[model samples]
Target: MKKLLIILIACVLGSNIGFGQSKTKLKEVIVRPGGQKVVLGTKREKADYGHGGAPNNPKYQTAYFIPAKGASGLIDRVGIYIFQKHSFLEFLKPSNPVYLYLYKADAKDLPGELLVPEPLVIKPKKNTHWYWVDISEYSIALPNDGLFAAVSWPKATKEDNGPYVGMTNECDSCPFYLYHFPSEPRWLKVDERMKKSVEKGNKEKLNQNLMVRLEVSLKK
Candidate 1:
C-alpha cells in the first residue's frame, strides 16, 4: 500500500511539472516577435514620431520624410529618421514607438516655394510608442501661421535610454515601417499663443527648414 501511494504522488508531481513547462512554452510563443498587433489611436489623437540609425545600412546614411497636407509656403517639409539605433529600443518590442524631434529653419534656410503632399494616417496602441508627423497644429480654420513641420513620439519619455523599433504580428518576421499624418482638431494660432507655446521650454519657433531628431528605448 505504501508503494502504491508513492507511485501516485510521483505521477502527480510529474503532471504538474509537465503542465508548468507547457505553460512556459505557450508564453514564449506569445512573446515571440510579432505575437500581437499594435493599433493606433483615433483620428482625434496626435501621432508620435522618432529618428535613429540602423546598422544594416552602410554609409551610415539614412533619410525619411513625411509630407504635409496643406503646408504650401508655411511648412515646406517635415522630416525624421534614425541616425543610429542609439539604444536597445531599436529592437526587441511588440510594436515600434514614435520618436519626435524639432528643427527651426532660419530665414537664410528658406529655399523656394513649398509643395503640399498627402500625409499618411496611422493608429496608436496602448503602452506602445508610434511615430507621428504634422504639417500644421490646426489646418481646418487657421492654416497660415499654424504651418510648421513637427515629428513626435508618443508614450516613450525622455527617461528611456534607447530607441526601440516596434514589431507587430501582422507582418511578423518582416521589417517594420511607420505611417505619417497631420495633427487633429486643426490647431489655430490666435494672437501668437501658438508661437509662444513653441518658444516655451526646448520647443522653438517655426523655421524655413526645420529638422528634429528623436530616439526611443523600450522599458523592460
Candidate 2:
C-alpha cells in the first residue's frame, strides 16, 4: 500500500510538471471602442461587389498594405466587410474557414515572408456590416516598411457553398492590392485597373479593392 501511494503521487507530480511546461503565455491586450479606432487601410462606407465563388478559385486571396504612418502601431483588430445573400439553410451550414496571414513585401512589392507563421483562422460570422476579429492577444507589430494582410479561403466543396466577402470601389488610388494564385502568384493594382476599365468601358478586366482593414493603437 505504501509503495502504490508513492507511485501514484509521483505520476501526479510528473503530469502537473508536463502540463506546466506545455502551457503558453498569452500577451497583454486591451480592446478600445470604435471612437478610439485608428484605421490602417482605405475606409469605405460600403462595398459594391463580392469575390471568390467556386472551389480552388484563384480570387480566394486579397491583401492590403500598411502605410508608413500607421506602421508603428500595434495591431489589435481586423475587420472585413462581408455579404451573405444565400438562403437561411445555406447560411447556417458550416463552410471552409478563412485564414488571415501577415506577410512582408519583397523587392518587387509582392508578398514575401509570412510574418505570422501560424496564420490566424477567422470564424465566419453572418453580418450586414463589417465582421471584426480581435487579434490583440497575438501582439502583432506593424513592420516599418509595410506588412500585407492576406486572407485565403478554403476550397469550396460541392456540398458547401462558401460565403463571399464584400469588395469596395471607393478608393481610386488605394494602397490595397488583390492577389491571385492561378499559376505563379501575382499582385494586381485592382483599384487603378478598375478605374481605367470603367473609363474605357472594359468590363472584362474590371476588379475592385477587398474591404479589409486593420485597427491599431500607436505605442506611447
Candidate 3:
C-alpha cells in the first residue's frame, strides 16, 4: 500500500509540473523565427507615472508614437511595463483591467482614428515587469511612419491597488498623445504641455516616456 501511495504522489507532482510547463510554452509561442521581431518603444524603466501609472480620468488613454521598424510590417504584439506600490498591503489588493488600443498616425503626426474594432482589455497576471498581448490575428497594417500603441489604464480600485505603467527617464524625441475629455473628448498631442513649460522659463524638460513597446514583423 505504501508503494502504491508513493506512485500516486509522483503522478500528481508530474501533472502539476506539466501544467505549468504547458502554460509557459503557450505564452512563449511568439518567440519563433518566422516574424522579424523588432521591439519598438522605450525599453528603459526609471519610475512609475501618475500614482504608479494608474489609469485615471484626465488621461483616459496614453498613446505612444512608435516609429515603424521597416518600410512595411505587421505588428505581432504590444507590451507595457507595469509595477505596484511598495507598501506591505499591496499584496492584498487586486489591480484593475487595462485596455490596449491601436491608432493611425495622422498627417500632423498625431494619433488618428481607432485601428482595432474595439480596445483589448488586458488583465495583467504579474507585477513590476513588462506585460504583452498577442494581436497578430488582427493583422493591423504597420506603416513605415509607425503606429500609436495606446494603453488605456483604468483607475485603481483602491489607493494601493494598481496595474501601473512605468515611465522611461528620457522621451525627448518620443511623441505621445493624451485623451482630453468632459469638455471635449479627443486625442491631443502632449506637445502643448511642453510648450507651456518652456514659456514659463522652466529649463528642465519632462524627458519622460511611457514604457510601451511593440514586436513587429517586417514585410517588403
Candidate 4:
C-alpha cells in the first residue's frame, strides 16, 4: 500500500516524493459551525488514479459532483483529502495556490451556475489527510439534485504542480468533471475526456472522482 501510494501521487501531482503511510480512518473534522457537519466523498482510502492539468491548458480545473446526501439548507465548509508530493527542503518553498469554487449541479449532473461570487484562495500543505476550509461565510445552499466542489489551477501551471487532490475507488463510482480554460462550455465529464483520449489513439483514460467535498448545516 505504501509503495503504491508513493507512485500514485507522484504521477498525478507531477512530483517525485513519497505520499506517506495511509491511516485507517478519516476522523470527523470539526468546524466553527454549531450544527452537525457532514464529510462527504469516497469514504475510503484514496484510489490509485488522479487528475490535474492538461496539455495547452495552463489554467485547468477539476471538480467532483457531491450529492447533498441529506445535508442542511446552507453549506458551511469544504474539505479535500490531499497528499503532499514534496517534503524535503524543497518543501520549504510555498505551494502553488489554487481556487475553490462551488456550483449547483446541472441537469446533466455537471456544474451549473457559479455559487461563490469570488473564488477563494487555497494554500494547500505538504501532508497526507483531509484539509478542511471554512466556507460558513459563503452560506452556499444545497441544490435539490446536488452540487459540484471544484479546484482550479493558475495560468502559470503549464501541466501541473504538487499538492494534488485525491480520488477513491470505494463507492464503485462518483461523478467528476474537468474544465479546459476559456472553453465555451467550460466543464467536461471525466468519461468524456477519456473518450477523447481514445479517439486520439492515446492509451490514457481519466476515471477519477476527486476528493473535494463541502459541509452543510443540519439545522434549518
Give the candidate number with the greatest lDDT: 4
Task: Locate the minimum summed-lDDT window of 10 residues in model 4.
Answer: 9-18
> Where does candidate 1 stray beyond 4 Å?
1-78, 86-90, 94-96, 99-146, 158-220
Return model 2's CA RMSD, one decimal: 19.3
As for TM-score, the candidate ahead, 2 or 4, is: 4
* lDDT, candidate 3, 1-220, per-residue tens: 4344333322221221100000111121234566555567664544424223322342456677777644466777787766543345655555577677888978777778778888888766564556778888999878767788777655543343346556554556554565644345666564634434432444434433666777777663
For candidate 1, give the lDDT of residue 9: 24
For model 1, residues 7-43, the per-residue Cα lDDT tens digits are 3322221221100000000010112252321111111
Q: How many clashes (backbone atoms < 3 Å, residues ≥3 apart in a chain or on different chains) does model 1 have?
A: 46
Scored by TM-score, the top model is: 4
Q: Model 1, 27: alpha-carbon shift in Å? A: 48
**What TM-score fits each model?**
0.22, 0.68, 0.70, 0.72
The pairs that clash in candidate 4 are none
Pull out the clashing pairs in model 3. Answer: none
What lDDT does model 1 reach?
0.25
Better of 2 and 3 by TM-score: 3
User: For model 4, what is the C-alpha lDDT against the true structure?
Assistant: 0.59
